[model samples]
Target: MSMFAHTETNARSRLPGGKALGGLLQRLGLGGRGLVIAIPTLWLLLFFLIPFLVVAKISLSEAAIARPPYLPIWEWDDGLLNINLNFGNYLFLLEDPLYLSAYLESIKIAGISTLIALLIGYPMAYLIARSPENQRNILLMLVVLPFWTSFLLRVYAWIGFLKANGIINNFLLWTGIIDEPLIMLQTDFAVYVGIVYSYLPFMILPLYANLVKLDQSYIEASADLGARPVTTFLTVTLPLSASGIIAGCMLVFIPAVGEFVIPALLGGPDTLMIGRVLWDEFFSNRDWPIASAVAIVMLFVLVIPIMMLRKAQAVEEGAS
Candidate 1:
């Protein structure tokens, strides 16, 4: 064969293999993208969606002594779908003063705690953000270093500090500040302390993230125009950090509203949070349907704040 014919033969032989390799690579790329999407979707379906569906189903059910502990609302009868939903669980929540009070008190506690967290966190975050470049990382690390310890351990430690005979009371007594140990443990005061300590970082981190990126030129410009520090903060820094404020407040408030651990551990016997109620109904009373109803109602209550946060974030992104 001539040189040109030999070259043509070699080209034809390689064409199919090249095409196959390209097809394989394309298939792998598509598969990788699909896998990335599938993993999170599957995880949410399993953990969140399915669990919520189960809770919803249970909420519509009736209390029973049977194996699963609740009577099903749906049944198949005569080739038709039969539905028997007992809405009394939801209605009962409205009729019961206990439920109403618990919800209101939870809102109050969460709101107060969030406000306190913001007041405390904003300063800490601002200071951290304004620190020297080399020291900023160390300050941030110190803020987050508490997470290195177990949360349960931290809360337990607070118990030792807040108890009547705890270190704080003893120190105060020794210093002649009081005749006896002041009542601190198992009170609303203790609950607030535990919550603030536990969630302060949540409030600070978001504020820091926002403040660190703030343009210092605005402050300088405001000062140049005869704006006082407080005025500058109110008009410039505060407005710019509104997104962080919203984010931090949401992080603190949402979880605080449904908080079980802190209130259960530190709050008084009269402390009636919705979370504690839900826990009692589920475990103590074994009334799963009522617990589910409470949970569903809580979710409905939270939807408003969640939407507000989403809207704020969207607006911030748009402004940026």
Candidate 2:
């Protein structure tokens, strides 16, 4: 009897849940691949899609003097269901020229910052990628060293450098390059400088990753074919690193458009950005509907560029 019981236990262990769980999964058409895909899908649904839907709902509601500060979109009246959705919040945005100017200015600033980062980062990345094996790790570490320090502290340090009678102007004055201090603080130029400094690593890391993997043979062959250095770079290296350029630009531009701290601290009143406007709507004015509308529009604007970049990257990969 003990031997029979032991044999039964082994059989049950081999079969697991007696094939019930396996049969259930098979009937649901959920294989190992499906389970793996479900993780990210579930994550997005929880964190991204759910929050977006909530904001979207708020955007369609009317502002009110209540606990939530927005009128409910639906109500019950005489046993009949009634639904109310307010789109005036969006229309009001179009009617207001301030919002338009804010959007345009944000795009302009972010675009310029991305361009500056690319120009500065490309050379640094190329140098690091081409450096000796012993120095490569150290160079990469230096590139990311800024991240170890607090981001806010770094921005504050920039303030000290850019302020009148600060480090830069003082140095210039001492060198007799200028008789007086330069007005560098609270300006658009200061905003650009701060953004490029903060996001330069994002640009360089992608470029270095892409450039390091590039085959030396293509470059050598080009040089062998009587191509000059510039010609070889323009034809071979540049084309191959297009993916990195797109990725880095997208990373920098997206956050820069919604940047608030750098602009608020470094930029003057003239520096109009959507992020600032959103803050005002949400906090100062306490207009939840308008703020939600502005946020939704901004998301759509950023999404368009992201979709375009992704499509471009896909085409590039397919061609390669």
For candidate 2, lDDT tens digit of each residue in 45-163?
Answer: 99989999999999999999888899999999999989999999999999999999999999999999999999999999999999998999999999999978988889899999999
lDDT of candidate 1 over 252-273, digit per residue (tens) = 8999999999999889899899
Worst 10 residues of 1 by lDDT: 311-320
TM-score for each model: 0.87, 0.86
Q: Residue 78 lDDT in model 2? A: 100
Q: Which ten residues in a row have the lowest lDDT in candidate 2?
A: 311-320
Query: What's the lDDT for candidate 2?
Result: 0.91
Q: Cα RMSD to native, each candidate?
A: 7.0, 4.8
